[model samples]
Target: MTSPEGGGPGTPAPLAPLPPSAPLPASAASDLVLPRYGAGALSDVVPSALAALGVEGEHDLLGLPPSDRYVVMLVDGLGWHLLHRHAEDAPFLTGEGRIRRSLTVGAPSTTSTSLASLGTGLPPGRHGIVGYTMAIPGTDRLLNTLRWDTTVEPLVWQPHQTAFERGVQAGVAVTTVSRKAFRGSGITVAGLRGGEFVPADSAGQATAGTVEASRRGDRSLVYLYEGDLDWTGHRAGVNSPAWRHQLSALDHFAARLRSALPADVVLLVTGDHGMLDVAPDRRVDVDSAPQLRAGVRMVGGDPRLRYLYTHEGAAGDVVATWRERLGDGALVLGRDEAIATGWFGEVEDRVRPRIGDVVIAALDETAVECRRDFPMEPLMVGWHGSLTAEEMLVPLVVAD
Candidate 1:
């Protein structure tokens, strides 16, 4: 399995100039389930919730019915397909009339990107946190968005007004019920800012906090988050006994939170992304393969999705090499081709540099791991951050 280099993750190599290249054939993108940014997507959740609460300018693009209060609970890693497969473990979430539909999360289906999209009510292109980790513009260094670089201001990195902020401006009471540790984190400040933060570390606290926050005003929006399942999935495979146990606990949490909310409150449960277990044999370690490392300047994104920032004038060769080496196990595309496919939903000019010169989205159960750059990644059995149905399809369950 792949591991990180001695310099640790996000260590930069020099950037080489990349010349223009031919776009990938249309068939290259046909099989991909591209994110539906303006339609039924995670990004549309908050906007639709705000609209349901009668916020003046917010539109219910997701077609949610009218409600005075909304409790949006994001159970991290609860993919629609995963939940359906383990329905018995989560009866409350899969019960009749609970699941409205599955929503497509943003490309590079990681928590940072999806949350930014969900909070800002905009695509990754607009929000600018394009991946879990991405190159900091004009520098060889990569920014691990979750850990975040202190020098880069969160507010400046993501300048758009969040849905929570917009809801507050429109006279709606908006609150966020999440772990106390996340109250002032970079991800929260950058994407989910501008709401009353109520810290809740346990299921009981989450239930009580969500109920109380939803009653803040006649028009209220409350967002609750639980990351236990995601943490379990990463530590253990998605279908492993541990993951299933976590699913059961999550179902109980949801049931408790739902039962405690006032009758008028609408409960919407969703997830950031899904996960699939990758066998050690299925992983191709770039650190062990010189050809795979050739022309590469730095690595970003996660194992399932790789952002290969190549050296000057090396993108074409790097893309060709990766396509040839990975063969049918991955879809390798140039940056321009990737953008044209609308995976990121109309990327901004400033955001373009954050994307790699060559992007590789894993196909099937394959993973491209760089042991040296990402030491801990290869050890994790379950992974996401690609466009597969398993990684992109999150449920939007409505319980009233």
Candidate 2:
């Protein structure tokens, strides 16, 4: 694969540690980096764009400079740490002034939760799409937010109006460019609705659609979604050559979009979350571990982050057992403690039960999988959705 203006793809770059930021909360666990909500976060992106577009009542929390036309591209699974690690493969993106700063993805660091935060300009607590798969209150089954169980109404599950809708109401031309298959998907209705949907099957189409939408009304906000990189990471671990090649392709796509847009248009690139390769020995299968099975009723969330719904009054035992068995490989906390740490950011009473009775966040490269519950999860090479820096820190590149 041909790389952009950066160093040759053959040149390997040293993985850089996360840039220093504000001090962590004293209450936070040693292994966790709490999501920075209401400040620099995925939720702040759209509101910041709206503010830059001169939309009234919207706050530019990210401090985005003024711009008449804005095109915000979300590159799924493009994390800040990952970008620096493979900077040679994506020269155009890592160029000086191209990256504004890093933003903390919402808790769990999963696509569904982060996307909801990005679209609604609200934390997971308010948006209600807390995880990839969460318990549907009053039901025994899990609602897969990505695949989206149609039986559940999207609007009702997440009642808040999206930032895109708010932009339209303010007379700003808002358009979303993504795969045609996602035109009216459940997640779209719940998080990204209230804007005109433009289908773009390829990178060229995405560039065309974005350029056209950016040229609309005096003030325009266009959102473009790219998921191929994330898909590649899930199938072939981020450390694989395939992922590096895909990164190069995505870099070219961004370069095309930036060059096509007018000078005055501000092009911002960001991502939902990051990923890390999980080894087979590093995984703990709950299906085979009798201690992990005791008292747990249903499993939600993903391998990296687990939500274990416990039977009545079994939450304490389940938490204790998980902490003991997993010992240092994960941080096991009850729902109240997880909320108290502000990982979910103000959990609403209505959205509380959807969280697990016992929450487990895999530390480092460890994963707690239940192959019996989610058969396909263990088969994946890459995993995310924990609070580690590798998964939680995503870039906010200002490719103007």
Candidate 3:
């Protein structure tokens, strides 16, 4: 694996915390660091690329080269640090001599929320897909954004028109390539709708779909998605042999996608969020801890960052209890404090209640989880969604 622009693989450099341009209170900086929005953000990618290619939109943040044909491929959970650490397994990504830069995903650093940011060209606050699982506000039931709980309508929950819509309106032929099962799923309707939905089950199929769409017109924009790497990371920690095998496959996939592209086309590779392996001892079961469950009506989000909904007027008690119990392992913040940190990026009035009364962001390898509430969640080996560098920093690599 080598660095972009003709160099050998650089040593794996740990991501630094998000730096603040303006003064932040010592307390706030100690607990949270918000996503860097206007500049190097995942939400800035597609919009800026489109603008460079003559399809204008609300964003033009990252100055991607102008190209008539483009393929934006997102590898789920491929954090910048993870890729750098395992560069030997991903030669194509680290070897190619193009442009490379780091990008930050939206807060809560989960799949659905990051996808919404990518498609809508907005932050978590504006897109309103704040977490993996969040409340429907004024209701006790949790709305799993990934599953798209039937109780909530996707469009009503996320009313913004997507970047796909913008491409279509500008007469740029747009296509979305992903697993066939995701064709009409709730998350798709809310975030990835408006483009030609092409069902692609394998990497070859994804490449095939993109090529077919690209040849259909003189100018084209195809979105290619692959999730097997993320699936492997979840079942077998990112450092495990299974995950390394998946990483090797992704390196080949990157080469395959590029080999099949037209000479004029530009291929961009990126991801939703990064992953970190959590040891068994680091897993804290909140369901079994009375202090964690006390005064808490429901638990939302994932293991790394948990959203706590409390009983009527018990918000204060819940905050104090979680801080006391979790101590330095987690930072217990009120909803207002989290928002004030600008993590969600100008949370809309309608989106406020969806956030928990008290949010707990795990500070290290520790995971604040409730196993029984979401049975499948706790069984995973890799976890993300925190202010940690491994969870927030992703790569934006280009091949022309």
Residue-by-residue lDDT tens digits, candidate 2, 89-156: 99989988888999999887899898889999999998898899999989899999988998999999
Q: Whole-model Cα lDDT per candidate? A: 0.88, 0.88, 0.83
Q: Candidate 1: TM-score?
A: 0.93
| Model 1 alpha-carbon drift over 4 Å, by segment | 1-28
lDDT of 1 by residue, 1-400 (tens): 2322223245533222122222334565554678998889999999999998888888898788899899998988999999999999999999998899999999889999998888999999889998989999989998898889988889988998999999999988999999999888899999999879999998888888888898997689998889999999998999799999999999998998888899999999999999999887678777654566889999998888899999999999999888876666679999998888888998888899999899999866778888888899888999999898899999999998
CA displacement after TM-score superposition, residue 183 of candidate 1 (Å)? 1.4
For candidate 3, what's the RMSD? 10.4
Model 2 spans > 4 angstroms off:
1-28
Across residues 290-389, which tens digit of lDDT does each residue of candidate 3 receive? 5557789899988898999888889898888777666566778889988888889989999999999999887667787788788887789999999778
The estimated TM-scores of all candidates read 0.93, 0.92, 0.91
Candidate 2 overall Cα lDDT vs. reference?
Answer: 0.88
Candidate 3 Cα misplacement greater than 4 A, ranges? 1-33
As for lDDT, the candidate ahead, 2 or 3, is: 2
